[model samples]
Target: MRLEGVFARYGRRDAWVLQNVDGEVRQGDTIVITGRNGAGKSTLLRVLAGLLPVGRGKVRDRPDIVGWVPERFPTAQPFAVLAYLQGIARVQGLSQSLAQKTIDAWGERFFLTPFFATPLEELSKGTARKVGLIQALLNPPQLLVMDEPWEGLDAQSQAELPAVVEELTKNGGSCVLTDHRGRAADLGDVRHWQVHQGVLKEEDAPAPQEDAEHHVIEIVVRTDEVGTTVEWLREAGYDVHGTRERR
Candidate 1:
């Protein structure tokens, strides 16, 4: 997706929250938006999710299948966990059987299966966030937008969330997310963007090493594929040694 001179604000009378923001989001890109509180980070995410309209300029090539996990998961909703996720699946164009299967799979993956029958209002904050995250992935989206998705999640869930995002990008999708606590340490390869005074700029990636050095790396494989694995490794510029059988 590409943003060209994009400008946005809450209302016509309100001051602009984003002004002349320009950037491009490519496939497999993990973009992180960082800024102080009330600096329009959420608004920028809303725009990218196609929830907020641009006041001027253009945001083109946005994916139609956009999945967004808001910072605040609405707990006042009346639907139960499974029902709500099934509804989201239907909205994402899944059939009834497929929707149920997806709900079951994601519910188990996120540890929300036990609470499948519980109403959204009855769940704890962490559980509610899990439901929120699950809804976003009922159908793998082409663009996944998350605002503080790591908040309120347990240690295990927090660790798993980055892996989920990596899977999306690996499948040729993209992600845009914001977090304040620096909890997303696993997303080290992300493009860091800081929004300030309604302007956006790409932070430079770390420089590469100037010196070349060789380091020892150990390889282990099954006996059957040892020859092929060793040959491939050596072709890729690795120093290969004879394989030793382990007792």
Candidate 2:
């Protein structure tokens, strides 16, 4: 999928959210978008997903197989959690049984099984976000676009997301995602781009350093054992700093 000279504006006479943005993502690859608040990262994802119309550019992609996980899920829905996702799957061309099975599998993985029969309005913010995420992955779309996919998620849920992304890429699928927590590092061999001042630029991250001298070390011995460890280190001629206990 690719966008050629894409430009987007939110409202009449408003400043352009995206200006002359060009981006490409081939199958089996992941693109990570990073920027400060209001940098148009989410807008770019929407454009690529074909959810928002572009102002003055061409977005060429397989729309039929694109799945989008918006930043916020619609909370006013009258459908149950599983039913809503199943509905999306059905629209994506899955059979009724297949859609139900897919929803069940993902619901189980995301710990949404208990909430399967619950209405979306009754779920918490974090759980709603999970539902949005699962809906995007249920049908294995060719292109997946996610915005803040890991936001408001618990630690276990956050850890499970990388596996889902890996499955998508391994199946020759592509994804464009925006995240604030730097979880994109878990995507492995992903291309990083940053939006700055309405311009999209390719950015290179520094390689991880292994030199011990350049690293900050934290020794977390228990409070009772800290004194012993510090004393032992000092006796071994190490530059150790110790604090006494308040009697």
Q: Which candidate gets the maximum lDDT versus the true structure? A: 1
Worst 10-residue lDDT window, candidate 1: 232-241
Screening candidate 1 with a backbone cut-off below 3 angstroms (N, C-alpha, C), the clashing residue pairs are none
**Tens-digit lDDT string for candidate 1 (104-200):** 8887778789999999998766788889898889888999999988776655677788889999999999999997766556786889888998999
Largest TM-score belongs to which candidate?
1
lDDT of 2 by residue, 1-247 (tens): 7788988987868889999998778998788998889888888888888878888888887546788888778879899887888888877788988888888888888888999889999877678888988888877788989888877665568789888888888999988899775677887888888998677987785356574674335576678787456645533434443455545
> What lDDT does each candidate get?
0.85, 0.80
Q: Model 2 — TM-score against the truth?
A: 0.81
lDDT of 1: 0.85
Clashes of 1: 0
Error of 1 at 53 (Å): 0.4
Alpha-carbon TM-score of each model against the true structure:
0.81, 0.81
